[model samples]
Target: MRLAPVRDDVAGFDAGEAAAFDPQPVRDAGGSGERITSLTSWWHTRWCQVCGHTFRRGDRVLVADSRVRHLDPTLDCAESGGGRADEAEVVRFTEGLLATWPVVGDVPLTRTDDVPGLLAPPLGGLRRAACLFCAHTFRPGEFVVMCPCTPAARVCARAVHRDPARGLPCWESWRPGSTLKVCPVTLTRLAT
Candidate 1:
């Protein structure tokens, strides 16, 4: 990946910024004295800090994010017609996704509160979830991950009745006043 030049204003004068601003210099792992080629390739070959899994390039992967937790690195799925993913791979994949995406279980806030905290301006991307039971897909517009109910109560409800095959209530089923949860297109549970 191409890295942009670090702007003076963006770098700031903070001590913390100085320590972690640049990517660590990668040594020749095999002692051949050649510089590493790519971030994705280097990450796969080197020891991953987030998850302990070591990997190589050309591995098929999946990404997941839980906003409450750190993002995972790219994962090497065991079923991806490749070898089983190591523990480090799994952890890194989780952390990377969380860091990159507008994840579910993320803390909700008003624009005034959240905007300043963001690293960049709001991004438009699809956020998806799969039903554990029937494998049906749900996107952000179709469902609200951060429910208004208590966390414990909401977790239980989500676990017990989130199967699309079971025909659980739509977003409107619970909150009639919510304009945010409906499908942006058909205003139904499954927005085409």
Candidate 2:
């Protein structure tokens, strides 16, 4: 459907007068990695090779070397397509991995000029056969891994989800009038 052209006299157009225009309030997802006036964020959707789970824009997930593919169709780890590994197989991959390497969550990546290759697209590309969720950035003759993670471990994804109880889009930049930061779960109970 075509919308009426907006007028420069928007200030004079009150609610009833603008009804024919079908105006929509501006939205700021804030977490969509938009490059606003002065700030920019980097967040992208990725798939979990181990569980075949597709993570959304801001989810935190584990990553491992892509050379090793995990998660068979039956939810078991496998070195290759034909062979299956049991629960212990996952332990082999995820166990001491965290003890030695810290878990890296999905955070926005910004370009840095100081790092020789940080601003360049990952050398092998974001999806590489040898890398899980990310590719590689090289300096001179060496390969440098980007912000890293491992799929062998699980990180809770609840924080990445929008508030389920309120079912409202993000309002970090919106202030219709007055707002409160009350718990929606409690508000639901009080309503009934």
Candidate 3:
């Protein structure tokens, strides 16, 4: 049985190890005091599945899972040596972790003013999110990034660059952020 890891990260983790700084989200007054934006950042180490290399920052590497699995069907993902996984499964795993991982950040103040309601969710105004790299849809488990650039922009670090001419669809790039960074695969698809 492929067990999904039990997790406490979706709610956000403490930036510091001290119990004093653990994320104890208080709901906003204007918005439901249920969800507050996380001030923490997200990141993952770059590793080569074939070579076992832990890449340093700014190293040219596969930054998205989509690109990784697609790039070489024979390559076992750096962490998946015990089993074989298909492209869909790999992408799904990446997507799930990105969505559920509790961020390490500060609790945002609840808005007492008119906070914009998300137009798409069945929950009336709950934050809606998508992968920054692939634009895959997800309902945010963490408070979605509501930057002035896009009030409802949900993001992930799974980015890729496309190479349509060479038939290399996309490759992972780097860390994710609150703002969307549409994958080249999607961009190429949209351009057509």
Best by TM-score: 1
> What is the C-alpha lDDT profile of model 1 across 42-147, one tens digit per residue?
3344332333233323323332231011122223222233333475775565445435543234333111122221112223542222322323333221223233
Number of residue pairs clashing in candidate 1, backbone atoms closer than 3 angstroms, sequence gap of 3 or more or interchain: 15
| For every candidate, C-alpha RMSD to the true structure in Å | 17.7, 20.8, 21.5
**Local lDDT at 38 for model 3:** 24
Write the candidate numbers in order of decreasing TM-score.
1, 2, 3
Ranking by lDDT: 1, 3, 2
Ten-residue region with minimum lDDT total, candidate 1: 63-72
Give candidate 3 regions above 4 Å deviation. Answer: 1-119, 122-129, 148-192
lDDT of 2 by residue, 14-42 (tens): 76587658856444344322222211212
Q: How much is the lDDT of residue 67 in candidate 2?
A: 21
- Per-candidate Cα lDDT values, in order, are 0.32, 0.29, 0.29
Q: Return whichever of 1 and 3 wins on lDDT.
A: 1
lDDT of 3 at 166: 20
Prediction 2 global C-alpha lDDT: 0.29
Best by lDDT: 1
Compared with the true structure, model 1 gives a TM-score of 0.21
